[model samples]
Target chain A: MSGLSKKQESLIKSLYTRHGRKKHNLCICEGLRCCYEVLNLNPQLVEIAVCSEDFDLSTLPAVASEINFIRVPQEKMKSFSSTVASQGVLVVAAKPEFSKSDDAPADPYIFVLDRVMDPGNFGTILRTAKSVGLTELWFTAGSVDAFNDKVIRSAMGAQFGMTLREFSDLDVLAEELRRFGYNRIFRTTPHEGESCFTAPDLFEKTAIIIGNEANGAAELDGSLSLTIPMPGNYESINAAQAATVILFEYVRRSEGGA
Target chain B: MSGLSKKQESLIKSLYTRHGRKKHNLCICEGLRCCYEVLNLNPQLVEIAVCSEDFDLSTLPAVASEINFIRVPQEKMKSFSSTVASQGVLVVAAKPEFSKSDDAPADPYIFVLDRVMDPGNFGTILRTAKSVGLTELWFTAGSVDAFNDKVIRSAMGAQFGMTLREFSDLDVLAEELRRFGYNRIFRTTPHEGESCFTAPDLFEKTAIIIGNEANGAAELDGSLSLTIPMPGNYESINAAQAATVILFEYVRRSEGGA
Candidate 1:
């Protein structure tokens, strides 16, 4: 019952060879949750691809009619799957603009990563940031490709309305965020003078910069906390975990009306 | 200069398989930092392999003399390497006895993962736990093999002198730790009850059970916490990150003298 067109197959295959994400500002979203999320949000989804014959259309909202589901072979699905598991569903969605909107809080808090190498870490951070109402995130050189298939799967569908921009020269992003008045930036560190719990809360105009896996941020110098861990055997936690602990604390403080 | 004996080649290649890690109880440590870290502790090294003739060994500690040096074909070294970039160094070192040595804290705190999947996350968390002196880490059935190359690399040579046990059934572990009087076994969750810091500070025979990537540990209904963020954008950090945050907090309370 699959009705995949050769033309569509060629299109996505062409996408694999090119930096379609960097060039076109889009990435592929796979599986049930991500598709459902984008469907619920009614965003600009380029197309939906399905390999199963019994693909359900009823669970989706009426706007789902607008979603294009081209059929493809399961083999092709395996080849295209970013996740180790193929959930038999896929969509190509426009990368959301992290740029703040009027309905979004007037003072937007942002998260930025510099060359975080793991896709799972990247996705988990995105999922948490979205839950906490982060409006935008910018990636600097050395970060993983956000649209990477592994990232799509690991994000657990948080990419639906997320906005992201990758800058080849990350050092320049500080000036750019400043243009948007996101000048109060905080960097997350396991080593820091202040505990993550009591660090200054995220103001409306804040940008949180996370660092590389091994090295701290290449450009980060004067972060609020330089050493957070106790003198102990464990030198540092995973970078993504460090970011999550600090991010959640920021959100907690924000929620408490800090 | 290529003097890799057939026996040496087989031994190193055996490490590529799981049987190798189990049979020899040794893992391959590659790159300059790991090689030196192994040397610093003066581990029972199997041998040292170098791909380049120009690699300077003058500054390495005198303990390195006991290490057998085998120069392999450069192309093969590149093939076996976990990292693409190379300083032309690799060593196979015995997995130090992870049992609670006198070095182990008397309180005997442990960290647990239900089903952590990523090698990097597992490695990073293992490193964090090791840093915090939580050397007694036992893995549930579905967790990744602790001795995998990526995990070894990510642990940053911290795997030394650590105990990791894989139980065929978590029931045995749950029963065992329970018998051991870990009355305060807890799990970390953003959705649940107590904050980690506020949750009765734990010491002496404690276990922190972290869950899988998609599902945090199963709701054993007894030990859970209010999930929190990293004070960054992520609503959740990757499993590695989550484990790091939780494990280090345990470290801080136990070792931080806070």
Candidate 2:
């Protein structure tokens, strides 16, 4: 069994913070499932794989062989874990670099998260976006760090399959979207604008904006606002739930339903 | 300002547990939004309202005057709080009594949660169900308690507007659903059965089952299965996200959209 050096331990601990992750250009993927995903889907980004003595190495993917592996006592592994109950495995990997080129794809369907602060909500959005076949996600600067431990855990390794980009300003993002041939920029309101279901050409070259938990989306110039048509008395659903509903609507429409 | 009695303090602490909630036939509604909701939507259920000295009574609804109001120091209120930061207010109220009679409604849309263990997921599902105009939800006995503190917080007081009921067994629930004219019983799989969007007559007299986070739905005889198609490599989205997508589809279709 390999032991973690003091320097390695320090590095792993630092990854819990956004500043540290940015400094090292690495993020921690904790739990067995997340570690497996980082190793299986994007093995090239993985720098180190650490597991407790009881964790079965045979269960890991074949690509895990190429990565540096560290084995330690269960108690030691738990110290490095962010979750209350560690799954006995963790991985440190370089953050994926999404393309920032000016070229726009023929059919762009993007999810732009504007100041979504909740880690769980952000993570669920990433997971939902991936499930609906989205390749990339754009976030405003104020949104929670994509690599936050809680976000990563809730995302369930959906991050490995997604290209995440961040923008400092909504107007800048709007300008860029238009440049990329995204003709329809949709933002959801509690009750305003056209109903999402009845909105014409919703799936074609679209960029949908999901806002923060406490506040709706930040105002973007030239963006078409749409509502989910909440018939119930409550003001609105949570941001993550709202995002999932809208994304799946795209899926439904793309599949020739309705 | 009225201080909490020793008996009242003990009761408030005990309400944190499921057994205590059952024994007292009451649940705690914490935070400003939730307290506001319980008071506004279902004031009759409110037995006692407790607040920190700093909480402004003027902001509360006119109905607040009818309930027993107790005031305590912020530090004292924090001691009884289940959350890290109490929004300075809490409400102890009787659990809403949903109808148990045999009569079938003319048109019914029910959410059947089977062993959903995550409080956050349960709460989000409740919020989504309410947003889509659902008046009630049914749960299999093994599911997490509807009145769990985390569930209440995450649900953002949607419980006040919802009729919650429980069935000890999936079979009994299925039989009851049939008796209630729920002809189309749908449970989601990762990828199987009919696509949720294309499922014919999905919204008419339907009971959609949301399963546990780890294990899928409990098998019920004669229930039709449906899936939200995921083109991504991930196995599945979280239970709450999946439920929202499916429920909103009901909203979309009912509003004459695909």
Question: Model 1 reaches what TM-score against the true structure?
Answer: 0.81
Candidates in order have lDDT scores of 0.65, 0.85
lDDT of 2 by residue, A90-167 (tens): 998888877656645433577889999999999999988887888888889999999998898888777887778788
- Segments in model 2 whose C-alpha atoms lie over 4 Å from true places: A103-107, B103-107
DockQ of each: 0.31, 0.79
lDDT of 1 by residue, B1-258 (tens): 558767777787788677998898877887776666667654565444454555667555577666666665567677777676766878877777655422433446657888888787787777777766654677887787777777877777766656676666556666666766665677766566666554555555667777787778766645645454434343355576556556655644543322
Per-residue CA lDDT of candidate 2, range B1-258, in tens? 557889988998989999999899899999987888788888999877899887887788888877778888899999989887778999998888776555454335778899999999999898888888888888898889899878988887788877787889788888888887787899988988999889888888888898888899988888899998876757789999989988888888888984
Residue B226 Cα positional deviation in candidate 1, in Å, after optimal superposition: 5.7
Please tell me what DockQ candidate 2 reaches: 0.79
Note each model's CA RMSD in angstroms.
4.4, 1.9
